[model samples]
Target: MNYFELHIGDYAEATQHLSILEDGVYSRLLRKYYASEKPLPADVAIVQRLIVAKSKEERAAVEAVLQEFFVLAEDGWHQLRCDGEIERYRSGEPERKAKKANEEERMKRHREERAELFTKLTAAGAHAPWNLPIKELRERVAALPAIVSGDEPATPATGPETLQVGEPATAPATPATATQTPIPNTHYPDTNTQTPTNIGINTPLPPKGGRKRSREPVEEPQGFVRFWAAWPASKRKESRGKCAEVWVREGFEALADVIVAHVEAKRDQTDWAHDGGQYVEAPMVYLNSRKWEGAEVGAMHQRKREVVI
Candidate 1:
C-alpha cells in the first residue's frame, strides 16, 4: 500500500474537469486512502483533519471529490479504484517473494562463476595476481564464457617463466558476494611470494569519532493507523510505540474496524471532552481499558467482538 502506480493519461482524463485545488485534494485523499489501505471516513470533517484541509475552498473540494469518486458504505467511503489497487498488491505478495528469491539466486550464480575462474587462473600461475586491480580482473573474467563450453581455456604467455595457464586449481572455498566481495585476508609481499587468503573483502574503517548505527523504521498496522488518525492529537497521544504493540498483542486486528469506528464516534462524548481531553486517555490507556464500549460494556464488548472476530 506504500506504493501504487498512477497512469498519468488515465488520471488526467478522469480529473480533467476538476479545478487545480480540487485535483490536489483528490490526490491527497488517495494518498491517505492507500497509506492506510482503508476507506476514507464518512465524516467530511474528520477527512478534512486527516488531510490537513484548512481553507474553506479546500474543505468544499473534499466533499466534491468524495461525492464524485468515492462511495459511502456502512464501513466508510470506499473508492473502487483504490480498493482494487490495494487488493492486487496484497494478493501479489507471493509473486514478489518469488522475484526476490530469483534475484538472490542470480547473484549467487555470478559469485560461483567468478570463483571458478579465479581458481583456474591461480592454478596456472597466470598473471591474475592478487595485486591486480579488481576492476580489470573482473572485466577480463566477465568477457570469458560462463563455462568455457567443450574446450579448455587458452593459456596466455606472460614472460620467460612459461607458467601453465587455464588449468583449474583447487576448489575455491567460497566466493565474495556482490554486496561484499571476498578480498585477500593475508598480506602479500612485493615479490608476491605468499598466497593471499581469499576471505572477507576490505571494509572501510570507522570514522574518527565513530558513527551511530540507525534503527530500521517500523511499519504501523493499517488498523492502528486508522485508530491513530481518529485519536485526538493532543499531548495525550504518547507511547505510540506501546500502543501499536498492544494493538496486535491483544488480537485487535480482528476488531480494528470496530475499534476505530467506536473511537471516532466517542471523540465528542462528555467523558472525552471534559477538561480538553485531559481525561481523554492515552491510546494505550484507551485500548487497554476498552473505553470504547460504553456502560455495561463488558458483556456487550465480548458479544460484539465475537461477531466481528
Candidate 2:
C-alpha cells in the first residue's frame, strides 16, 4: 500500500509484539520508542531484523507475535505495490502521450495553412505591405534552439575546466550572490516599531507603451463588395465617358489640387493623390463601353389606304 498504510501496519505489529512481553520493562521501552517519531524505512527494516536475531529472551518475546507481524508486513508491501500502480495511472502519462500526438497534428495543420496563406498573399502582391520576407521569417524561426536538450550546461559554473580551450577567464565572485542571504526574524516591541506610510489608496495607472499605446479603437469603414455591379451599364459608361471627362477638364484638375490639400491638412498624407497607391491618377476617367450594331425601324401609315378607295 501507500506510505501511510505501511506505517500504520508496522505500528500495529510493533504494538502487538510489545503487548506479549511478560516483564513490563520491555513493554515500556517499546512504548517509548513507538511514542517517538517512527524510524525511517531503512532504519525500521534494520531494527526489525535486529530484534529477531538478538538474544533468546528478545526473540521469544517477538516470536509470540511474529506470525501476525509477518502477515501484516506482507500485506503492507502488497498494498504499497498497488498504490504505486495507482499513482502511475494518476500521473496522466497516457493522456500526455495522446496530447503530444495531437499537438504534432495541430502544428502540421497550422504550418500547412500558413504556407497556403503565404502563397495566396504573394500571388496577390499583399506581402509587400508586411515587410518581412518568407525566407527571412523561416531563417529566424530556424535559429531558435530546441525546447529541451540533455547535454546543455547547468546553471552553476561547476563543470571541469579544459586547459587548451580558448575560453575567457571567469570573473571573481562579487558581493551580489554571497551577500543576498535571507535575514532572520527578530522580535520588535509594538510601540518602538515605525508605522507603515499612509500611501495614496488609488493612484491612476501610468501611460502604457508600445502595443498598448499604438492600439486605439477606430470605426471600421462600411461598404458592399460588388454594390454598384447591378447599376445600368450604359448609364455608367456615359457618366464615365462624357460627364466625368468634361467635369475633370473643366474643374477636375483644380478639384484634385483641392483634394490633395485637404488630405494633407486633415489626413496627414501629403502626397496621397500623387502616390502610386492612390486610385485617381493623371488618366481623367475610366470608361468601360461596348459597341453594338442594330437594325433601324421605319415609321408605318395606319389610316391612309381607306380614303383613297
Q: Per-residue CA lDDT of candidate 2, range 1-309, in tens?
A: 111122456555556545545334334323333333232123334444544435666555544433333223422311233344446545766796898799768657644444444444433333321223346535543443432122344354655364348877777767777667554323221333323332123423333431122322232111111112212223222233343434334432222222222223322333422444353322123211100000000111122322210
Top-TM-score structure, candidate number? 1
* Clash tally, candidates in order: 1, 2
Worst 10 residues of 2 by lDDT: 290-299
- Provide the overall lDDT of each model, using Cα atoms, as 2-decimal numbers: 0.69, 0.35
Clash pairs of candidate 1? 176-182
Q: Quote each prediction's TM-score.
A: 0.40, 0.18
Model 2 has an lDDT value of 0.35
Candidate 2: stretches off by over 4 Å = 1-92, 128-309
